[model samples]
Target: MEHPLPECPIARFLTVLDGPWATLIVRELLTGPKRFTELRAALPGISPKTLSSRLRRFVLIGLVTRTAYPEVPPRVEYRLTPAGTRLQVVFDAMAAWAEQDLPRTGSARGADR
Candidate 1:
């Protein structure tokens, strides 16, 4: 059977956020505004190029805002907009569910060891 398209706004939003590194990037931004280097340090595995692309996409989607400061060395920071801040509710719910339903470690999905 052919798959039906997702019709809900939540589903549509997830499609954008469900991409690799997107959710993690959102989580990091939730804490506060962060510079490029700070986000890179927070998420150890993401490549600089990939992070740059994701930041661009997020800015385009209006979920994130990029601010540049004029200085000897230019500095840029990323922060979630009001629309993006609303997503924290969904993120919190997901985290709560995972904490309760998933095993802490060993043989379970996402277990470190």
Candidate 2:
């Protein structure tokens, strides 16, 4: 996202949620923690490399927590931090707006409509 002149606060937030993948990842994790394979299964659109890279960035930024189990067959799960969990409201509002307004504006398909 282009930094809006005059320093907008929402722009800073959008910088972290820069695209569909990041937001969708948050949405998936909102349901609860999930293993790598489960996230992949839930989000088939994202490639393994993209998912891995995005997850690393999320972890670095403290939006996500990664837990690895010690076992012969390792188990790893990704969970959202409290800050990340709060994003569910933002997503819900966005979804509601998209459903109600997008089609009227002819900018996007209103999936709910």
Candidate 3:
């Protein structure tokens, strides 16, 4: 028989958002819906292949919706679903923590060598 799944809420949430580059992608989407190319431009460090994979995972988890428009060139846009929008509070709390409690080391304070 298969083992029962874990009951922790944090673990459950992370399972959906724990893939490589997932948080960065969600942060980008928090700004607004974007086309694939636009998201690539905004997140300069992510490769096209990785971005595609992350988008696929987000769709699977129902956090994002991809819409396609028929045009001379097919147009696709990614937007956060209702579930995703609700995560903004979590993101905001994280941001607030970073700003308020991050260590004020010399490097963090921008002290030059």
Candidate 4:
């Protein structure tokens, strides 16, 4: 069954990428396609279960695609769809904001007034 997204654009975005892992996973995929082991290695401290869960959620939401090939041991690759690639602009904007707006450690810029 298909689920409707929230009316608000921000809410809809949050509904799709609700957690840190979601965006991080997308960021990794933005570089290129990767296998399970590669993704696990790239993201240290992320449990296999969590990675699997997030990938499955991404596949369900149309952000990622999983392709499996038949072979001796079998191989699987995960890649971002066009919709997923579109998130690059959002990530770029976020990076720009963080670099320009967010303060450094111990800086008074972001401190309480």
CA lDDT of each candidate?
0.88, 0.86, 0.84, 0.89
| 26-99 per-residue lDDT for model 3 (tens digits) | 99899899999999998888999999988987897689999999986899999999999888998899778667
Pairs that collide in candidate 1 are none
Instruction: Encode model 1's per-residue lDDT on 1-113: one tens digit a residue.
Output: 15654799879877669765999999999999999999999999999999999999899879999999998699999999999999899889988867766756634465553
TM-score of 4: 0.87
| Steric clash count of candidate 1 | 0
Query: What local lDDT score does residue 78 receive in model 2, on the 0 to 100 scale?
Result: 96
Write the number of the candidate with greater lDDT, choosing between 1 and 4: 4
TM-score of 1: 0.83
lDDT of 2 by residue, 1-113 (tens): 24343368787787678898988888899999988889889897899998999899889878999999997799899999999889899989998988877866577664556
Off by over 4 Å in 2: 1-7, 103-113
Per-candidate TM vs. native? 0.83, 0.80, 0.83, 0.87
Of 2 and 4, the candidate ranking higher by TM-score:
4
Taking the tens digit of each residue's C-alpha lDDT, what string does model 4 give over 1-113? 28788889999999877888888888899999999999999899899999999999889878999999897699999999999999999999988877766756636454454
Q: Give the TM-score comparing model 2 with the true structure, all chains together.
A: 0.80
What TM-score number comes out for model 3? 0.83
By how many angstroms RMSD does model 3 differ from the true structure?
4.8
Q: Where's the lowest-lDDT run of ten residues in candidate 1? A: 104-113
Highest TM-score among the candidates is held by which one? 4
- Highest lDDT: give the candidate number: 4
Comparing 3 and 4 on lDDT, the stronger one: 4
> Candidate 4 at 65: error in angstroms?
0.5
